[model samples]
Target: MLEKKRVQQLDIPSREGYDAIFNSNFLEDVPAALAQWGSSRVLLVSSKTLAAQHGDRIAALQSALGSHRLANTKLGVGSHSPYADVRDIARRVQRLRADCVISVGGCSYSDACKAACLLAANLAPDFTEEDMEALVDERRGIADARPEDGTPLRPRACRLVAVPTSLSAGEWNALSSATNARTGKKQHFGGWEGGGQPDLILLDPELAAATSPERLWLSSGVRCVDHCVELMCNPESAEGRCEGLHGHAERGLRCMLGGLTEYKAAKTRARGAGEKQQQQQGTQEEKEEAGDKERQLLLEGVSECQYGSREALTGLLIWRVPMGPSHAIGHQLGAVANVMHGVRLLATPSPSPHSRALISFKTRPVSNLTLPPLQITSCVMLAPVLRWQAANLSNPHYKTAQAKTLAIFNETLGWREASAADAVERFVRSLGLPTTLRDVGVVSDEEVRRIADKTMTDVWGGGKRQMEFDDVMEVLNSVRG
Candidate 1:
């Protein structure tokens, strides 16, 4: 497994020429950058929430980049992506004659951007809501793929640019994941050609730092684990194939771990202690330097869309990443439970009856000495969420466990992972996050049973990993314990 080119290495910058475009205003130089990209008319893919929070950010674009047409697509993706969301984005991109696109907000918004680019760039023939319906049912990859002009061919040309407000590493992956409204299913699209790795990508940590700590932590946790597993899964995942403590991989590993350490220390003091925000707070230069280090450390496939339109003409391919168990399983749990994606990593859920995530132990082997789990996680991790009381079901369980699920989320501290279910409850309590099923809603004995059975189904997982009904029983039982 260490030698196999898994999927975790695809999120890095392909080249070293990207000039990060970042400004505290969120309105500074982005619009002008969009206008100057190329002859390709720019299309903006964004949501209501993002526009509202940073209305000036979008408006600034219109005023500065009057050189392009704009389009809007809305779907917060905290829950799921409807097929209509995809179609809406696609239709809008075509309407504006947008040659280039910019996505704003969370990973979901970014997904919308990718799908829009694919649809319009490829000119895929319109398959009514019903046509895609049939395709969704078939247990296979894309089939009957054809062009919109009645000709079956790939896309003509169009590019994508992403500006993520959350720490979702997907922004750096070669894959695009979204939920289909019509089919009520989650889908993954993988290939290469989809314009340049964004004619330009602007990753402003300020934007990411603004995200809810829950989201930041969850997303970064997923990425941290992916790096760990990927390094072992693909021995070449680090610095062109150097091994031991003497290579670039080791140095990169050190920085990531260092970041995690600082992250944890800051989180430990966030609870009722009153001294929060310390974990993510920073001066201007610190933020810029952090952003730079982040760019260099990411895999070499996906890059920040900071470069002008140069390499885009070379046919955008070769952008891929290798990921393993912690990632895939984490995805299944997040999609099914509607929880923050990274929380799944801390939870380490077992699939339902049908889904058994059996990993071949012999596949990839690495000693703890080479990789320090605690240091790596504590460093790169984001500030945790604190607010809910554990037992207050209707509110967040930042204090107790028997109450609610997604109560009042105070985006500030980190929640540690506890061993037993009780410990889990306590750990979440310390971070001010919900700790029980009742906190979010479902509580009664019958409700718990139903939750167990439903979790076992994991219908949205697309059978990628089957967790039987009994597994659901275990999870529910553990929560109670």
Candidate 2:
């Protein structure tokens, strides 16, 4: 118990050089990025859908680089960063002798391209499919693997520039997930040789607004919220290590949540304008203005997510604190259950019965820190406690070291006296996200069981507050509903 009160030191992870630019029509900056990366040959990795939508921009980039320098374009990349796809992409990069890789579209394109860049830099020229998969599998989220775990692997040979269109924010971290071809489970890789982090990130609001359904943008904002909350709650921060005045976690949460709220408003306005257009009430000019408004709002949201991504990655790099169970289970949900990554994070879930029981037992002898027992139930409960702390707590830094928690449930979801779990459920409902496992398309209890089993082995699993296998069963049973 006393050990829990002490702040512990953490090893800083290696972060390579990179640049980020935010503006509309910033695709023009690609050539400059290429130049900064010192690449004479460039490969553009994007999806066919994006190519069709932004053909002119692609053409312009190629024109800027001149046809001679543009090595090749690989389009129609798959989602979930499928293992075979990445390997194939790597082979293409190697064959073309591309010096820089540019990823467009969303998480899938960027993740696949990042893996390809890493492989092109490190692997032997004649590496086989079996060899690539074996290496990826071996380094896939080994918990104890650090920069100093051994000699640093080869520096990435090809530089990467990520241009994301959705809110997945995979480009911001030095880690990417690729699905294993055999089991359909997503495996984590990168961070060893800074293979995951991109050399440059371009945030062009107009491009981000093109994402359909508007749900991806909104829910992925919640995923950023999850990242900030966990970093704040992590009790692993050392006393003097980067313990500066800046509150990275709190700032991150503020940016993410505030961005989501603004984006929601913009989406509502856009829908209204579209409906008006359907009714033939709004003029063409008004419709254009509405579209521009939505685009600007989308850009704002993306920028906020980018800022939060920096803070989250900084915490991950400095503290080396394992990602909380929410991330662990969310990855499994994406890989095993086929739920989209953002949707998995946004899905409303009930508290695991075993976790509830653990909280009850632990809080039986209440202490002065005012920690909420029910907050232990699920990751969705993060918002309320954080809101409470921001409003009530005096300490600038959340003293998770002394209390082993930062959660202190108060009014959230606009509810006066609801439990944290209930509040979270209601909040997620307000966002129109799935409220249960079945709602997100889980097929069976056995599938949920399999996900729970695999989650235990995830690199992010088994943290100080993680639910064990039996506890995971209780959660799965609730999700089965």
Specify the highest-TM-score model's number. Answer: 2
Q: Taking the tens digit of each residue's C-alpha lDDT, what string does model 2 give over 1-481? A: 0011111111233443455665535456777766666688888887566567657766766788787678888876665777777887788788888888888867777878877677667677677655555554333354113343453445567778888776566777676777775775667666643546787787666666653236656556566666665665554544456483127666665566556666677777777867778887666898788777676665676566656655654566555665556677667766776553222232333453322211111102223312111111223323333433334445545544213222221211123433434434444455555444554556587888877777777776532245577655555565454
TM-score of each: 0.54, 0.75
Whole-model Cα lDDT per candidate?
Answer: 0.39, 0.58
Quote model 2's TM-score. 0.75
- Cα displacement (angstroms), candidate 1, residue 470, comes to 6.5
* Model 1 RMSD vs true structure: 14.6
> Candidate 1: lDDT over CA atoms?
0.39
Residue 112, candidate 2: C-alpha displacement in angstroms: 1.7
CA error at residue 226 for candidate 2, angstroms = 1.5
Q: Please list the residue runs of candidate 2 whose C-alpha ends up more than 4 Å from where it truly belongs after superposition.
A: 1-16, 125-129, 136-140, 143-151, 192-195, 211-213, 237-246, 277-298, 340-420, 463-465
